[model samples]
Target: MKKIEFYKYHGLGNDFLIIDLMKKRPAVPDYNKLAEKICNRSFGVGADGILVLTKSRRADCCIDLFNSDGSWAEKSGNGLRIVAAYFHSNYARKKKLAFEINDEIADAEIIKSGSKGFSIKVSLGKPDFETKRVPMKSNGKFHINAPIEIEKTKFPVTVLSVGNPHTVLFVDRFDFDWKELGKIIEHSKYFPHRTNVEFVNIVSRSKVVLNDWERGAGATGSSGTGAAAAVVAGVVNGYINRKVEVVFPAGSLYIDWSEKDDNIYLTGPVAFICKGEYLFDAE
Candidate 1:
C-alpha cells in the first residue's frame, strides 16, 4: 500500500481522519476492519473517527463519517469545521460549495484566518424531544430530570436526542469519577443504543461547563451532539436562556438552543493536526 494523503484534525479533542475521496472512492475491503485499523494511533491512521469528503449536489459539499467502532454516523459537528478547512485549501478552489451531509444540507464558507483554527456552522436539523424519537423507553413527552442509574451513582438526567441519543445531567459543580462513570453510563440499560452522558455545571443563563462521557469513542472525546443535548436539557431545567456555551477541556462550543425553533445549531472550530499516508496492503 502506498502512503495515501490524509489530514488529521480535531474538534476540541475528538480527532478524525479527513480524507479526500472527491475524485474516486478508495478501495476499502472491510469498513469495520479498516475503522479499527486506520483509527489506531499506534497501528493505524490514529483518530477518533474517519471523515470522508465527497461531492454533493444539494449543499456546499458532503461528509460521511465513521466511528472507530465501525459505526457510520449522519454527521459530526467538529468534523464539519475540519472538512471546511480541507475544502478551502484543496477542494474549495476559492469558490464556495453547498455542503450536503448525510442526506442533510448546510452552507460552509472559507473562513478567513484569525484563530488557530477555522470555524464551520452546521444546520443540526430539528431537535426532536419525543421519547420515541430520542429512543428513550418513555412515552408522551420527553424525559427531563429523569432518574437513571449507572453503577452506584444516580443522577437525574434529561433524555434528549440530537440526531443521536444523549442523556444530560445538570450539576451545580463538577465532580465524581468521570472515567468510571462515563463508560458505565454509556452502556447503561436505559439508553438501548447506549448514550453520550453530559454532566453540566451551569455558569450562567447562557453558559455551561460540560464534561462528557461519550459513547462509541470514550471519556477523552468531544461530542457536538452531547453539547446540544446539554443545551436542550438546560432549557428544560430553566437554567439556560436560549444560546449555550459548553466549555470542554480542550476548548468550548457555542450552541444555539432556542425555544422558538425546533432545531439546534452547534458552532465550533476544528484543528488540523497533520497529514499522513498509510500502507495498508502489508497489514
Candidate 2:
C-alpha cells in the first residue's frame, strides 16, 4: 500500500534504521507504533532502534530516537555518530556537524573517511551525577559504587545520566549470568525510568571490556552511550583512566573524558548496511 524509504546503519553491531523525515516528510500519525512495527526483528526491518532525522532551528538537524520496543530514548552515542556519518556523507559534507536531541545540542566531527565507512567523534555533553536527575529513588545522594541487591546478589553499581540514565557494574570476569542480572537491574525499582546497564571488566587503566544491555533493547553487541557511561563510571570510581578504550564484542570505541571541558567524547566507526523501501499499510 504505502512504501517508506529507509537506510540501515550500524556502529560496531548496534544497528539502527534511519529515516530522513526532513526529506520525506511522511505524515505518520503515530511514530511509536511505526517504530515498533519497523524494528520488529521477526516481522520487519530489524534493528536495535529507529532514528528519525528532522529539521531543527537550534541546530542543523534534530534526532528522535526510539528503541525497538517503541520507547523514546533521550539520547544515544552510537546513534548520534551514525546520524553524523549519514549527514556528513549526504547533506553537509563537513568535518564538523551539530544536532539537537531532547532540546540539547550535540556536536560531531568527521575525523576520517574511507570506502568502508566514516569515523565519527561526537560530544556526549557531560555526565550528570545528581540522584534526582538520574531519576533514581535514592536519598538525594550520588550513587557512586553503591550496592544494589538483585536476586540475593549484592552488586556494586554506579548510576549517572549522560542524556539518559545508566547503571554500571564492575565485574572480575564474565563467568556470571550478566544478561539475567542486567534485565533485573534494568527493571529494578531503584530506577524510576528503566536504565541502560553495562558490565565492565578492567584490563588496565586505559582499557576495559564492556558488555551492554540497553534500556528498551535488550542485549546488544555494542552501545555508544553505554561505553561512555561505563568509562565515566570507571573514572569516577578510580577504576580507569580519563581516556579509555572500551572493547565490545563487535569492536572497540574510544571514550575521552576531557578534564579541561568536562565533556565526554565518543569516537567510533559506522558502517552502511543497506538502503531499501518498506511497504506497509497506511493508517
Candidate 3:
C-alpha cells in the first residue's frame, strides 16, 4: 500500500486537497488518474480538486492543479492562496511568496495568519480578452456582450481569460436557472477548451454578486478566477469599477484590477480544515 499524506484547505468554501510532492513524492506515473481517485467524494477524500505542491527551479514552488474529474487546469486563484497559507504555516514563514504554474509565475502575500485562519492576497496575471487567447471559436474579435443561445433563450456574455477561460453574463437576479445554463454553456462548441461560467448581478459600481459554475467542478460556491473574470467583464461593459467586492454564496472576495499594472489582485480568507494520510494501491 502506498501512503500519501495530504492537507485540506478551503477559501470561501472552495476546498482542495493539497499534496506536497516535495515532501513524500509518490511513484504514480499518471497524476490524472491519481487525482480522480483521491478526489472522489464517496470513495475517497472529498474535495473540489487536488493541488500538488512541488519544488520549482524558477520560483519558490510550483502548483499542479487537477479538477475532481482529473482534468488538468492551467491556473486556480483560490488554490494558490491556499498553497500560500500552507507554505506560510509550514515552511516559508514569510508573508510574500512566488509560485510557478507551468510557465506562468504568480505572487502571493499573507496578510494575516492566526489559529483561526489565514487571509491571503494573490496577484493573478492580466486578463486576456483576445478571442484566440481565450481559445473561444470566434471571428478574431473580443467577445464582449456577444449573444449565445441556449434552449431557445439568448444570453449576452463577455468571454475572457484570466489564466483560464471564463464566460461572464450580467443577470438581473439570481432566481434564474443558472445551473442549467452553466451546464450547457460550459460544454458549448464555441469554447473549444470549455469554460468556467459566471452569472453576475451588479449591486453598485463597486459591488457585485456572482454565481459560478467552474469548468470541471460544476457549480461551486465560489471561484476566484470567476470573480476576477466577472469584474473584468463588468469594467469592460461599463457596469462596475476597476475595484469591486464580489459576493459568493459562502463569502466575499475583494478584487482589484489595477489601472497601473492591469494585474488582478484577489484577497480572501482561507481556513485550515485538517491533515491526514491516505493509503491506496497503485494502479
Go through the candidates in order and give each one's C-alpha lDDT: 0.74, 0.92, 0.91
TM-score of each: 0.89, 0.98, 0.97
Q: After superposition, how far is residue 266 of candidate 3 from its true place, in Å?
A: 0.4
- lDDT of each residue in 144-184, candidate 3, tens digit only: 99888777878899999999999999999988789988989
lDDT winner between candidates 1 and 2:
2
Cα lDDT tens digits for candidate 1, 1-283 = 6445678878889888877777867786655556667887787778888877777766656787777776776666666766777777665455344577767775555444344876766556666778887777765477788777666767788887777788887777766676677788778777677777788898889788888876667765577877888888888778787687889998888888655766777788767789877666635
Candidate 2: lDDT of 76? 94
For each candidate, how many residue pairs have backbone atoms clashing (under 3 Å)? 10, 0, 0
Question: Total backbone clashes of model 3?
Answer: 0
- For model 1, the local distance difference test gives 0.74
Q: Which of the numbered candidates is closest to the native, going by highest lDDT?
A: 2
Where does candidate 2 clash, by residue pair?
none
For model 3 the TM-score comes to 0.97
